[model samples]
Target: MIQKLKDKGINVIAIEGNHDRLFDFEDLSWLDHLKRENLLILLRPSVRDGKIFFDEWDGERGGMIKMGNLRFYGIGYQGVNNSEYVERLGELLDPSFENVVIVHSAIGGSSMGLMPGFSKIEEFIPLSKKCEYVAAGHAHEKKIYEIEGTKIFIPGAPEYWDLSENGEKGFFIYDTEDKTYTFIESKKRKKIERKIMLQNGSEGEFSAAFSMAVDENPVEKDSIYSITIEVPYGVFCNVNLAGVEQKLEELGALKGRVVTKWIGQDSNLPDSSDDLDIERQIISADPSLGNYAPEISKAIDKLKDLHRSGDTDQSSMVIDDLLDQIIGEDGI
Candidate 1:
């Protein structure tokens, strides 16, 4: 894609993220290959004797690139919380032109609570004061924050890394003249979520509710889905969430997740501290795994029966298949 862009006479400038570095070797990075090939321009700053200096590349001097009235500055992953780096970068900024600082760092006040060890947006107050726009990366959610006259632009990830990352996944195109940025949404894979709450704990009730939810909607092909079933603790053992996932897969879902939530704890149940009985202890140990108690119990019963019959070959096959079915190819 970089080659294609280069062919079109378009300049591709990129900053390194944490994953782009080969940490084992000093001053080495995965992006070195691209830089060597001249497919793209690398503009990340370098530190020598505690002093920051930009790598001169593509006829551009310093860490600054000039195109018309806009100046682009790139900084890679250098622990944003590091006061030294942030302070030095502020010293490099030229307030004469429309400046855009593209840095891969977490930038937000409340984000510090959600992403510990990340630099607070306040840390970049100096840089934000000098630049017109601070384009940030590393976080997977799209957000914009204005500090003084500068705006922080986070375009978010181009694709959903997991079900939890639910939002418009894409990049941004900033208009230098207008001082406005427009989000360009990517044609990434869609994520769908379906949740069901059950009042009755019976197997019949569970199956009927699941079937109705599935039948009511036409599952999109090649789309990811999350199916959440909330049931009373007593009835959780009787319901089969795995079956619901299987049905969704059969209906052309690229992938499916079946999350079983056991609600309303039973007073008669054993305490989680009781390790004497493995089956009972498992249910009491973690509420998240409690929904699997019935399936685990059934599997255990079948294995015991096979053990008594001395069917070693059949037992091995059953165990292997069961493990594969439950764990999947990726092992959870």
Candidate 2:
């Protein structure tokens, strides 16, 4: 693609993310080819001591590019630098000329979580009014938001990744003369977000819920989907994650690709098990607890207390012991 673009007298500037380096070392022939063609490839530095600093030559860390009537300043990862890169880039912008800022990171709730007190999004508000538009990547979902007469375009990814099944995979074409931006959709596969609600019930009920979810959101063989299971508290008592994975694998063979399977706690459930039997309660009270250790530790403690109080009739004391050992070793 770089060769084709360069052949047509178009200057192609490529920015490499963290994931891009892995493939570069594995199969670097294409990169060599692009380098030979004088393509501007911006390589990101490795993270050291919890910080990833960018150099000026690293696509100007905060620099400017003049393309026809538009000036583009590329901002690598705003969340990594806490929008310092964006702020620095803003300083370099020529306020007189029409400009566009291109970013390789996703803004808003998905990538960097919620930027509450920082007002990082607000920083771009003034810049948007100064520039013609802003183009960004990293997010797989295609979105465009106009704030203060400035258009923030998340062109999304040209390829499918993660839970972007519902996202539009495309590129953006910004006409410098007219100052208009248009989306050009890619020929990549489509994705879908399928959620399943499992009420407080037995293992069979959970399975039925999964089945029903798949049935309702029937995906094509080539389509990818993210199946989010909202299991109520105490409902997944007998549910097996491995079994669920196997079932999903089987379903994948029948219906498209099941890229990710996430299990979330129902919001209606109690926050803690103070009133109910903690041993019977699910270890995760919220969807965010999937990999959170503190919540897992609390659940382990509850189970241990249940075992100590001789409430092992329906629950497994052995499992409680194992969990305690694991949590103790990990210091969670």
Candidate 3:
């Protein structure tokens, strides 16, 4: 696909994230192909410890680089010098060329997973102040706007890495001659979420309501879904969540998670821990054991716990008792 773009006189420049080098950065045959396909992958040329983060990535680092007529002052993830790496980059940058800055760190504030911590946002402010335009990577969510008088841009991931994140995936196209940028949303497999409030509905009514909700916000073929229905405790035992998911699969969803939230406690069951016995906990922990008789389930629990905790001397006796309870001293 990239070669097709190159055939049409287009070029690509990109930054690498932690995910690119998570394992050991040793098996990077893909990087070589990217370089050959009219693509420029940027990185910090050297580290403070004089060690290479990636073995085959030979690209420009923290400095100025002019591609065609556009000039940029940039830094790679490996080239960051201090704890306040963003601030240090701002201080070192001349900002005289085109007044644009690029880096491998996150810029749109704190995010979960591979993105930088919240405090790093403060360090990022200095770079924002030093340049008129700043673009960054490492965030999985795309964001673009002015923060404290500086134009900030984050192009997220080109592809959806998590099927659970319900967001549009895409990249950015910056027109250096006009000093303008535009987002290009990619058409890829997406994940959609449907949350329904089961405030008032009978066991018979639930199936119809679920079907209507699905029809209103239809699931696309090859797309993933998570349909969550919040139901009252009284209706919990009657509703078949698994059946609902199977129905959604037949409609189009490639994968799905059908979940129900039970509100309030059922008054019929005992709520106090003190009222429960050892036999109850085993059944509660592993619900499959509930099908067996109480005495057998309790005996099985004792044997399993003893075996797990390495108390084998007593387990043998418990095993013998369990076998006798089952066999009734008969040969069969």
Candidate 4:
């Protein structure tokens, strides 16, 4: 695909996503294989404000390169917002050359057409003054907003990585000569969603219903088809999930996830995490946590104690206790 993109004269400056551990190649020598082919030109900055850094940064992984008359500066993913960095953006940005800021973080702002699980609009407003456009990623929904005369364009991930990312899939084509960009929709893979209820049905009956739904959906040769089914516990227990998925494959489904929900068990049961609403309420009630809610959530998830709690050596402890018991019984 990189070669194809290059064939069409589309230069791609890629940054690692959250799923990618892009820091192993500090020397940048491993990328030589791709660089030799002239397929990709990475914008991995090594320094900012005269201080050298390792990986692509959040605020300033500063590097300037001219591509087709347009200068570009990139701040790759540091995996955190680091909102306060916006204040020093003016100092860090080089205004001498007209350039575009390529960041791989979601510049959260403007709730208009916001997708599920997306970062809300935040402190990237100051970036426009420093650069022509802030081309960002990480939000799996395409959203472009003109904030303070700067185009905050986030060309979301095309191939829906998660079920929530059921939005249209595409990438942006930046025409450097014209100083304009356009979204090109790629229809290689289509996403299909279905919600079905098969109340009081046998395994074969449920399978027939599922097969009917799949046939009715009309998924392409290689596409994603996700179905959410509401059924009784007995029906689910009898249903062959793998068999259904295999049937879907035979019908030309490339990949999919089947979500089952119990209806007759308890209709009033809470959805998702039961404590999520309570957690949000707590955050709303507390002014301090509310102000820095995002940060607090990140910190809470990073607690080492919570990570280590499940790592107890129960087998070793039991062996040691058994050894003590054997030592005492030897006298008998």
Candidate achieving the largest TM-score: 1
Task: Give a tens-digit lDDT track for model 2, residues 185-299.
Answer: 9987556666656666467777787777778876456555556555544344456655665565555633333322223344444554342324323344445333444445544
TM-score ranking from best candidate downward = 1, 4, 3, 2
Report the poorest 10 consecutive residues by lDDT, candidate 2. 110-119
- Whole-model alpha-carbon lDDT for candidate 2: 0.54
What is residue 217's positional error in candidate 2, in angstroms? 7.2
Q: Which candidate has the top score in lDDT?
A: 1
The lDDT values for all models are: 0.67, 0.54, 0.56, 0.56
Model 2 stretches with alpha carbons more than 4 Å out: 21-33, 40-62, 110-119, 192-220, 225-232, 237-332
Off by over 4 Å in 4: 4-11, 19-21, 28-32, 48-62, 67-69, 81-89, 108-120, 174-180, 201-205, 218-220, 231-238, 262-332
| Candidate 1 Cα errors over 4 Å, as ranges | 58-63, 80-83, 109-117, 200-204, 232-243, 262-332
Q: Which ten residues in a row have the lowest lDDT in candidate 1?
A: 108-117
lDDT for each residue of candidate 3 in 1-332, tens digit (9 for 90 to 100): 76677788765555444444432553343444576554654443344574323222335333455554445655554322323555555655555545666666554231111112222454566765557577776555677656567776777766665544545558777776686778888876667788776756455677777778888889889777787776654454366777777877888988777776544445344444221243454455555434444556556555543333233345566667666765664434
The sequence of per-residue lDDT tens digits that candidate 1 reaches over residues 1-332 is 78999999988888777667754675577677787787777776666786787554455324667777777888777643445566777887778877778887766422112222146666777776688778887666687777666678888778775554666668898877687778998777777788778877567877787677778766789988787777655564466667777878899988877876665546454444221244544554576555455555555555543343222234565567557655774465
Superposed on all Cα atoms, the candidates' RMSDs to the truth, in angstroms, are: 12.5, 10.8, 13.4, 11.1
For model 3, the local distance difference test gives 0.56
Residue 102 in candidate 4, Cα distance off native in Å: 0.8
